[model samples]
Target: MSLPKVRSTTVLGVFHNGEVALGADGQASMGNTIAKSNVKKIRKLQDGKIVTGFAGSTADAFTLLEKFEEKLGAYAHNMKRAAIELAKDWRKDRYLHKLEAMMVVANKSELLIISGTGDVLEPDMGIAAIGSGSMYAQAAATALKKHAPHLSAEEIVREGLNIAADICVFTNHNLIVEKPV
Candidate 1:
């Protein structure tokens, strides 16, 4: 059986002035049809200290999320280490290597992207985005960080999402924002 490729959302993460925040749109598309409008792509994990956002098949993303959480616990809640470990496993493990999802995992102190190809990335400018509208959102956040450094982390990401939603039909302005408390 062949699985459909799902690219229906946008997720953005930003780290600024010692704070971290993530925002994701609420749109899920199935082929040429809109499947759902309020689907949440960002999630809080490890008692809300850790944040994760995903783009791809929802079911596959959830599977990766569960594995990533296990890695977190094994690595003692160290976000970076857990991300790296997950990437390693995702690329090397037969079953995991086939999972179709990309993830951004972050905390108040760090931001990283875990990919199925065994890549774990930390954005130099403290911003990262994924999914179909990722480029638009990333560019917006990068500009905000460079030109308007006074904006809070939440504001930067929210504005980024807004911009992405405007240009990317798969994305929307209905954003869920989360920050470290």
Candidate 2:
């Protein structure tokens, strides 16, 4: 059998009411076992102007985040430019090309999902999610956005992630949420 690799799952980002919030569950899994809990997968980048959530192999995700930050700096903090540049490099760079990770990044007005396959997508519905529990969290966020108009972006992310944690065995309740301020 192959050795187990630790990976993180369940990340959600919601843009609502002129605010953007990104969140992620804290469970890291190794094959069928939980390797760690309370691993923060959300961060504020560009000196708090952008919020980011990551999912996939823990070390690979960190590597991607660091590369993304470098792109942000090189691009003068333009999130779109940075994300696209990161995705471009992630796809072509021999080293980065081997990484397995995805990221949801946002500023107050824009939300984007970046993948190693050179995709930098802006969710038309103002929500983006990645990792194993993404679909569950995405569905939950969609319903909440439609029916619970009063909920803030962070609220939607929290509730949606919680719902995902309930449904996805790889996900958990320990969450880290961040918003650009």
Candidate 3:
């Protein structure tokens, strides 16, 4: 028997005010075919203090997230340090290096973006997005920031998700969302 294939796109964003949000389309594809369209890609951890969004191989993303969660658990009271440590570990871990996935994470004080390049990126504007619809989501978010600076972080997230949903059948309102405390 052959192994199952998975394809899904995830989106994540963070506002300058330290508010963070994550969104994903429900679609998972297998070998040029649509498999599941309503899968959740955003996860909440550390009693709602941490949020993570994943893109790429679902299993790989889960594995990375598990490692991140463990690190978070170890440093619950120190989110920034925890994030740095997790990103550093993710960048260097041999197993993680082979996985084809991207993740955006946020804790109380900062936002971190990680990808297959083994780079830990923190945008100057304090925002980032990952996955297939990331570009679309990023454009929407940038527009929101320029045209509607007063919008709350949650509102920005909703707008980004709506834009993504319009273009990708895999993403919808039921898309999972997680925010920071």
Candidate 4:
């Protein structure tokens, strides 16, 4: 009765020494089937100044990402304003309201998660994550961040996503990482 959604990515974000990195595994699946093994979920916008990772139905996620890019342009590339505007429109617009996607977005100074419910949230510890394997990735990132202060943001993100891929059936080790720098 529902869409054959592929909300299977494990996108993870981490911060270290004022730098932020975001990464996601390359697996996409629907139900018991692996739809794809190397889908690139990470995107760079604003000339690599903004990095985004998404999870959900692939087409829906692409639509939301495009809308988000438009919002960023309308807001003069201000990450916070664009995120809030995207959330507002996504929640209010009937077409967008039904989108089954979530995104983790980052700029050099901020990391945020935006949802279809009109929520734009910043993690308390400079970490953000989304998608089916988020809890596993987030937990691993948190642990790595706390205990491995020397690790780079990208290192933390990579390790976290790797851990998620090990545990989550929907996630795989083909990772793509990006940083806003």
lDDT of 4 by residue, 34-135 (tens): 989999999999889999999988888999999999988898899999999999999999999988999999999999999999999999788898988999
Task: Assess the local accuracy of residue 94 in candidate 1 as a C-alpha lDDT between 0 and 100.
Answer: 94
Write candidate 2's Cα lDDT for 1-181 as tens digits: 7898898599999999899999999999999899998899998986788988889988899999999999998999899999999999999999999998899999989999999999999997899999999999999999999999899999999999999999999999998999988
Tens-digit per-residue lDDT, 45-154, candidate 1? 97899889999988889999999999989999888988998898898999988888899988889999888999999988899899989999999999999999999999
Clashing pairs in 4: none
User: TM per model?
Assistant: 0.95, 0.97, 0.85, 0.97
Say what the RMSD of model 3 is. 2.4
Rank the candidate models, highest TM-score first: 2, 4, 1, 3
Model 4 — TM-score against the truth?
0.97
Score candidate 2 by TM-score against the native: 0.97
Model 4, stretches more than 4 Å misplaced? 1-3
Off by over 4 Å in 2: none
* Most TM-score-accurate candidate: 2
lDDT of each: 0.90, 0.93, 0.74, 0.91
Query: Which residue pairs overlap in candidate 2's backbone?
Result: none
Candidate 4: residue 53 lDDT (0-100): 93
